[model samples]
Target: MAIPKSAERSEVGAHQGSGEIRLVDVTKKFGGSYAVQNINLTIPHGSYCCLLGPSGCGKTTILRMIAGHETPSSGEIFIGDQMMIGKRPVERGTAMMFQSYALFPHLTVLDNVAFYLKMRGVGKEERRQKAEEMLQRVQLDHLKDRMPGQLSGGQQQRVALARSLITNPKVLLLEEPLSALDEFLRLKMRGELKSLQNELGITFVHVTHTQPEAIALADMVVVMDTGRIDQADTANVIFDRPKTPYVARFMGGQNVLTGTVESLSGGLARLRNADGATFEAATGALEAKAGSPMSIAVRRDRIKLRKRLADQVLSAVNEISGIVDSTEYQGSYIKVTVDLGGGVFVVNVSDSEYFVDAVVRGDLVTASWTTADVHTLSKVDMGAIDDPYLDATQ
Candidate 1:
């Protein structure tokens, strides 16, 4: 099943420019409702891109469109400069691994992986050899004789991945491929997917509602709401500097603060919330006038919390006084939820720091963060407008 060294090199060289995918103003409509609207995106050749959102957000629809299972109502899809509107799945140079890892129950693992080749009328010996090589590549060659029903979830997933990859596709589409696995297996398979994509040098568009999964596996994370993209950027940029409030809250690990701008000073804007609690944020080129609405995000890990003393006075600037609503111990850190009069704020206290002086429920506390930890949010409405400050972990 081993490929010759020169042949492998030639195959690797041919991967260039083959995996790039572009969608321009692509919209899908069922009756009067839009599944996806004016979607414009480009997945770089050989990069891992994640389409992340909640249920009914159209992530799976986008994946299907790219796989040729669903057609856009308008606009265009291009895979390496070739239009994909009328192309069949096989002709589009893409393969899909569904969330269920669709495999024939009657077929053995090796036969399941070789099914596509069989459809193409390949010689049985050649298809079997190629399927064995693929199974070996995915480290599942030892279980090739087992039926799909006999394999574990992770094993079945690998078999499915091998089946899709054996087609020598330029792009691979995954629809929540890890949702069926338990937490432990999910983590294990997440690493395998990324490693496999890197080794094969093919574009991977994975759809998932899990925030951590998307951030961990994607080079580019596209956050969608309803049917439109809220923000699309690198994982770090998306998490550290989200473009909109929906994205900031959806990505978690951030406490969003909303207010009205009271004044603008030297590179700083002062804002006052409905409760009259004032805060300051570095306005980095944002044009804001008095009375304009504003919102800023502060990372939960960046805020420091302390139990408020009976007689100690608190500073109004860069600090919030609240009662500890709850605390949950995560392995490395403690998630502390503080009840501000109108809303809740969260802070991630390192276990070491929490053990030094931990505060419990009903304890009066003060949470403080520096201006440098604050990031201004764009006013652009990308849906999910009801409560921007709603704690994502909840």
Candidate 2:
């Protein structure tokens, strides 16, 4: 549906508060290829929304479209009720924070932030005062006189944010703003960024290639794939109940197995694996008809590993016997790979409990999990899957 155009533009003489933004059927094409396609999103005032995806997945394309760096091939952009088509980004009450931290090498931190304000004909005294205030907000007040090249990566990012926010934009479009930082600095900056967003109460639309970055900072997360949105929801919902196989696997390491329901009774179904093993799992939204093939998934950490004989474990439930194939140390935890006939299944345990030398590759092991941990998916109805954008290809 087409959004109604805004009745009138705000008069420059009047200072007005920011408004909500809506993008309807936004699409962008680069020659014959689509950079982004059929994107519909609403950024409510004072909300932090994140566009999350892997490389070449159209996240940056969507950000560019909103920032007016790339015009939509065909769509309507709305700022509150105002139509933003053919309008420059600066006129649309929005500002951009690029990944490169586009600060001038010769310009001091304070001057870099004050550059935009000065261009708007704001007085030098007011602009300097405002820049200092922004610098303080970012905890970079002491570095005001330092040049961009003289500051660290995190410090430079603070300068970029201070510059973008000095204009007090209604909508802030950030494209992988923390990508240039090291791992430790990225985590520190993530907290600072979230705090800054909440304090300002401005609409923030951030784009990031890293999953944890989006998951940590977003009020709403939009996962994109192949120029389309795979899912849009809260982090809790996306993580707990991913709608598709692709999404389930993308969120973390999940073990997906092909099987068919052999029997259903007492809120549980007996599934016969393609390799002829049988196990029981809890029922889910996609009901498995008898004899119909389906896919089952369980997170690696959710499965329990025990060094017991197969017969001693609870065989009626979702129990399987395997051999410990290998183990990898991951600092806080150890990833144990158990060979369950068809493929290697991974289980995560605390490093203190599961060790490299504790269990040998040839030792027999039994892996078991409850019905609540099992998620069922259907192969025939791919659309019925939870997270279609999850890149299982990875």
Candidate 3:
């Protein structure tokens, strides 16, 4: 893919001399259980990285360790070339933006921002000037005299941001920073956060469980699952070519199909499940033979649904017959859920195309996808693909 011009531009207006981070053999254990297990990752200088996962998945533990609030039970962490095991947060050239905003309710915005400078023992006049400049950068200069209680949620967040950046830290660590905002404000801040990071040209390590949040802001996405990494790569690669079934299902928008390979010939392979239901798939880079287990995933949007007719059981190759259990109008497209007796699958059809589609609720339909859209899976339960949470969709 061609590089975008915005990405190729040189970084000339940036604070903080270094933003590189490296972690090697990092592990954290708590009461006979490991919160993080032997994690090794490197975030490039001047980049945006998001540690993405669900609750109790160790993403927050890793973030806290990076921010110097938690010490790792094992391994080394480096900010630039300096080891950060025993260092204080400020000493490590890093700053943290907490989820609560943690603004001082009693102090005015100017005082809240300049408090960091006060602790460093800077002159009052100079510190005030620096704080004023940071406030202007966040566009909160006019609210300098407002206390935290008097400011809006977004305004308070900007004040917190100004305080965090005044120290000129090499890297900024954000722990669920937007998780406290309302949905509308959360989305608005996402763009503001990304734009701020790009303008400053500093590394921002953000933690969040939201998939869309991770994909939108991250230059590098580190997806964690129960104390281990499922995949770590660019958002595009992780979304397009997931390496396992768990990643496929967790990342959303992919259907993980599993069965036994029945036969392989002429670069095509046949698969059959216990019910004798059959399908065809591509043999891409897989050395296949009869009776071998197979697991693959196809993008949800790639599937085409056709109304099933008597004696018509299959498409040209990969086909699945199911009952349309639900349909959701998603503005640009429609989400169609189909139940294949033992499993459930979802397909996204364009709104214009779906209005003319013959399949409807409770109707028998066959969902078909091409072999080219098939991607093999490695680690994860290949049992069935049924999402209980999806049953509650509005």
- Count the clashes in each prediction: 0, 8, 0
Number of backbone clashes in candidate 2: 8
Which candidate should be chosen as best, given TM-score against the real structure? 1
Q: Which candidate has the highest lDDT of all?
A: 1
Where in model 3 is the C-alpha error above 4 Å? 1-17, 265-269, 282-289, 380-394
Query: What does each candidate score in C-alpha RMSD?
Result: 3.0, 6.8, 4.4
Instruction: Report the poorest 10 consecutive residues by lDDT, candidate 2.
Output: 1-10
Better of 2 and 3 by TM-score: 3
Query: How well does each candidate superpose onto the true structure, as a TM-score?
Result: 0.93, 0.83, 0.91
Tens digits of per-residue lDDT, candidate 1, 1-394, equal 2223333421311233578999999999999999999999999998999999988999999999999999999999999999999899888889999999989999999999989889979899988888887788777889999999998998889899888878788999999999999999999999888887877778999999989999999999999989999999999999999878788889998888888899998989998877777889988867878898888999999999999987877657888888999999899999999999877889999999999998999999999888999999886333345653334553
- Pairwise TM-score winner, candidates 1 and 2: 1
User: lDDT of all the models against the reference?
Assistant: 0.87, 0.76, 0.82
The whole-model C-alpha lDDT of candidate 3 against the native structure comes to: 0.82
Task: Tell me model 2's lDDT, rounded to 2 decimals.
Answer: 0.76
Worst 10 residues of 1 by lDDT: 6-15
Candidate 3, residues 292-371: lDDT per residue as tens digits? 88878888899998788768745455778888999888899899999888878898888888989646789888888878
